[model samples]
Target chain A: MTVKVEKIEGGIPHNTIMVAGLIASVVLVYLTYANVLTGTQYFAFFGGLATVAALVWGSHTIKHLCSYGIGTGVPSAGMMAFGSGVIAMLFATKYGIAAPIVAVILAAVVGAILGYVANNVLNMKIPVMIVSLVEMAVIGALVLMGYAAMMSGSFELSALTTGSVSILGLSLPSYQASFLGGALIATAFMLGGIAIQHPFNACLGPSWTQDRMLYLAAECGFLSMIAAAIMSMPLISMGAALVSLFVAVIGWYYTYAKYIELSKRDAFSWLDSKPIPEVEGQ
Target chain B: MESIVFGIGITALAGALATVAGAAENTESDIGSQGDPNSQVQLAPQMGYLHRIFNKAIAGEPPAWGLWIALGAGIAWAFMAMQVNPILAIVLGAALATFVQGVYATTAYLGRTASLAKFGQPVFVDVLKSMTTVTMAHAFVAIFATVTVCHLMNAALGHPFPLPLLGLVWGIALGAAGSATGNPFYGKERQYQNQKYGAGVPIAASGNIVRYAEAGERNSLDNGWFSARLGGPASGVCFGLIVFLELWRTVLFEHIAAGWGAIIIGIIIILVFMVIDRYIEVWARKNYGPYGKPAEEASS
Candidate 1:
């Protein structure tokens, strides 16, 4: 007799999840611009929400692409998405109010071309490769811009490139504190790339499910947000940074609990193994 | 206007340099059996079919290239600040980076092979001595070209990003392009050549690499020769075109309507590629006649 194992599956369709995440992120990220217009950084934490949404979309796309059996290409795909997306994001920041929109367009173009090359030129023969790449690229750009807005309180080119420090209760320009000038953009790139890729990498297997992966993705996003919030302390107001941190902690807790609950539900059995007992000295 | 023209010129130069870098980078990785394919090489030993293959996968291509380019650019940036000749500084920095890469190749090859000694895989010192230099030479060419492209973007084009950051971004891009577009030719075609062409490695055949070459037992050096003909150049064009088109659009259209022109052109470019990609996919499917089986068999 042969025994067959079936993968357990139940969740919202991936397309619906992707579209919802995309729309939510784009709207939430724009709120940062509105907050900037009000000359206060209070709503800057919207950027963290936007990042979580984008990572959710991105992790799903990664799951879709890696299903094609591109052996060990999972992390490479994530890095490629961010590598190209970053160029688009940096370029788009020059446009004041339209930076986010321009970034999406630019990233889509870059991602589409990469997909074309991978399919036609390299002949990878994966059917959804092109569309998956385009989505990954846009998600990557959104994540970067979101984190940039979170830390710098704006995504404008001047805001990203200029530094500021408080000297004796007065704000003053200082190159060392700037995002680009201080090489903080590199940190953002690594943080965003890991957050987008790690969930799928950690959860992928024969029995992997979408809900668990996405929940972990959100948890990773919030963890990254906490880091960005800490980094933002040097760049934005202390009150704004603390608020971002508070929100990130709450998001992280909710997602972490959900992920654990899902793991228990999907698991065939669970053993709460304790630490090995120490032997007495001989 | 002059700056835009200069930017266009710089973009062209950077594209040319990137092409060389991409080619060299892919060839070097293929020769060393680095990145994802290194797993197969490692598995070959465990499965009891181990010849001489250089396994120098310290990390994936992106992070490895990121560290190398960042180091090169950092050193070059410092020297340029001290008023050294830019060309000399770049050469010195690339040489130093190449030395570090060679050291990594040596240790990785020795350590991984030594660990597999229980599986009867011998640590070939001669293979290590010879291949390390070849990898280093290719690494130097790739590093030098990438660093020059970063310098052109930062110093000549006046891109607001610093040299090291530009290096990191472009370095990761180059590595990604090579890993995505080139590795299959080495991993599937070169290493698993005994399998029928276009039929991917099946699960049952994992770790079963072709151990013999046309003349004698196969090795990583043989893989290099095969990948150089197609994989290396293909990766070059992929990366080179990405850099060229990205800079080209910005140079030609960035100023119009507050950079909206570039956005519009970018959309047009994507639509064109979408059409081309669809055509290619259909053509490949018709010509190749489905992956693993004949048309009649597949239909049945």
Candidate 2:
């Protein structure tokens, strides 16, 4: 008698697993604001980690959709996602944490409409086009808002408008707003964009697997959070930045090791073998 | 003052929404300051006539060392002009922007060629062509976006941004976006014919290079023609929206109120592109097909 072999499935669907983690992270960060976590360092460090986690999920989706070979190119998908995200975050911060629901509704509506148009009208022809577009936009918003809150040290309307003056029908810039708008927002914006999109773009082909991509995603996300911490140096407490830097290094090393392990399993070890002839110096 | 439910909901839903998008996939340059023939880069001949034309127009070889020199001068001139007059500043700035982009295009071509060659795949002119197309769009977006951001921020803050600082922001952002978007197209266009150990199995293999929305035959005039027609307007619209929104935000006391308007307008602008992109898709599919237009038809 012959026995049939069955292909094993991931214990939880990849998307489900990532989203659950993302939600948990956001809620945990909010606890810091609620006096539940206590300490500026607590908010900054955890908030940075949460922001990176969102991008990790974003990167996974990028890999999923781009694998289909969207004609417009992979980075376009990332750009489009960030574009919507930037808008949502700006609007959300304008309202402060008081009206969080507005930004959520705003991001979803924009993403859904864009996705619908991409799939139905543009005929982007990817099987996952609509869902991918919406998710990308929404996550983009989360990454932006989360990082903004951490850097500003709170989720207040003043985070956006605090640094400007009104003069002769023109608004003047304030150092705080400039730092947030220009440096902090710009770094998080671009870093989150790349963290989510770069993995799949770098690792496309037959060797590409969900497991491997997620591992790489985790690595990129941690690195970007480290970037956020560095950019936040002028604004956040030094303790917060130091803690974030430490956590990022540990997070990156762990994820990178997992990625290497996966890569070793699939890649040719011969490629890493020592050369038959040593270099002249050696 | 705190509602954990709503606050958490905002992030949670956004994350969940990203999940739907996320669950969807389930996962997955340096140019400058050097010389000598040995150090200078060159392109393969098969890159063809368009390569020659580009080289000639830029007044140097394919890597445009001469133009790189001109770009240095242009930047210096632009900075000087900034001290003289706004009109002169604008003119010199435009000149500087052109040379800056020319350097970028040349560098991108050389950079992309080296990258592909490292993997053992020969690049076609279409690789350069596709990159230049995206570069033009992104260059336009980056310049305008930078100017708008700086101008508005300065106006709002009652202090002007240092010109050098503005230039840095503008140049860095443009360069970043270009490399981010352009390199992937090169990776996508070619794959190993026989590789079990590698990642590059074609998603749908026809052995033909796949371009996203390029019009007409590969390397044909019509292809260049349509790409300009589509990409140019789309980029222009993006630039316009950014400029308008920045202006509106700067002038209004209610900046966030204006932000809402900006968001709506932004969505509309994107929707318009969607309509145009859709129209282009239909046109290309009906007229071109996978192999593109017949050579005879292409010539006409």
Candidate 3:
């Protein structure tokens, strides 16, 4: 007997979520810039929220692309997104206020090229490969830049490499010292990647539903945000980092509970088991 | 003008090194039955078709390569900072990284096989003893070449990023290239050779891989010999072109119109590949004619 995969139809479409995520991320990340101009890092947690928004979009794209049955491409696609995104993000950071837009454009172009090569040269032949890749790449750039902004309280290359100047009796450490110097970008890369990929990967199968997967994605995003907040402790003010951490923890708890509820609703049977029994021969 | 010439030289050398690294990486992965195809290898024992395929997939290619190359380049960078000879430093770093790769490979194999003990799959110590060295050798070559390319990008091309960062980036690209290009050949053609060409693996035949050799029984080492010829070279070209074109655009066109020229060139390259892909797709469809008949009908 064949097992038919159950997909709950008529939820919010992926495209809509993607668009909402894009808008929310862009606007939220700009809050960091605003905080920068205001001479305070108090609003830096907005950058963590921005990362969560980007990961939500990224998780959808990963699901769309992996549905094509490119076995093992899930992690590769995630890594490739960040690989190209890092190049574009680093280049864009040089442009100051224009950096975010520049990063989006550059990442889109790089992702398109990589996607084209995957389709044409390598012959993966998934229909949505190019567009999904472009989205993932942009999302990757946003996550990295957002987390960096949160940690450093600015996305400017100079501000990132060198600590922010004194403003309103508040100063942040250089990103080079706090982020790249300790290779925290690598941590960010892995954190963002696992968050984006794990939702679909863990929930994949005939029993998987879109809502459950997405909630898990949000939960994973909050978990990564918690890590980001902890990592920012040395760079940003302790109060700001603590607040970010607190918010992320709250978000994680809510999402995790929702995900568990969804899982229980979907499962054929739910049980609490005791310890294993001894063998008859024993 | 002189700097352009120097840039061109660096691009060429880096591209060449990337090509060799890509080839070695593909061969190494195919030999170990790593990547997406390892799913089949892992499934086989559980499905009661225990085989001797070496399973060494601790992580996906990108993260694995990122760790290896980053560690190598980090050590090399440290040594160079301490006034060590660049070449010697690179070699030492790569050698140490290769050792780490071997450790990962051994543990992965042992651990995976140990878990399958309930399936009556015995640990072939000989397979472990031989395949580990082979994978280590190829990994060394790949790591060495990749570290050199990152060094050139840092020392020669005046790239602002440090050595370890460059290593991490390009190492990911290399692994992505190999995983995308070569894994298909190994997964579809090499492992599932019993299936007809151009007919994709059906869902029904998921865990049932071709386990026997022409003589007695198949092992992972045999896969290396076959994949090295075609899959390895294909992966090499893919990665080599990526490195060459990316560096070429940066070197020649990055200054034109404040870097829009490089962006335009990148778009043009994508357009060219799209055209080629269309041609290939049309050609394959015309030749294969839509998968023909059902498996049962074809066999009958």
Displacement of the residue A42 alpha carbon in candidate 1, Å = 42
Quick one: how many clashes does candidate 2 have?
A: 16
Q: Which tens-of-lDDT digit does each residue in A1-282 have in candidate 1?
A: 112222325777778878998898888889999776798998889998999999988988887777766646666777877888998999999999898899999999999999999888988767888899989889888999998899889989998887676666787786756777756677567667766776666565454667777887887788667666766766778799889989998997798778656655554332222211122341
TM-score of each: 0.55, 0.49, 0.56
Tens digit per residue, CA lDDT, model 1, B131-219: 88889999999999999998988778777887767878888898899999899989878888787787788877788887777776666
Candidate 3: pairs in clash:
none
For candidate 2, what is the DockQ? Answer: 0.02
CA deviation > 4 Å runs, candidate 1:
A1-282, B291-300
For model 2, residues B42-82, the per-residue Cα lDDT tens digits are 22222211111111111112122212212222232223322
Candidate 1, which CAPRI tier? Answer: incorrect
Candidate 2 error regions (>4 Å): A1-12, A32-41, A98-101, A160-183, A270-282, B1-169, B172-300
The digit string of per-residue lDDT tens for model 3 on B1-300 reads 999999999999999999999999999998888878888887776666667678776467877777667757765664564346999989977886786577557645654555455555556666777888999999999999999998998889888887767877887888889999999888888888988777777877776787778876677788998899999999999999999999998899989999899999999998999999899989978877676555485553
Model 3 segments more than 4 A misplaced: A1-282, B293-300
**Top-TM-score candidate index:** 3
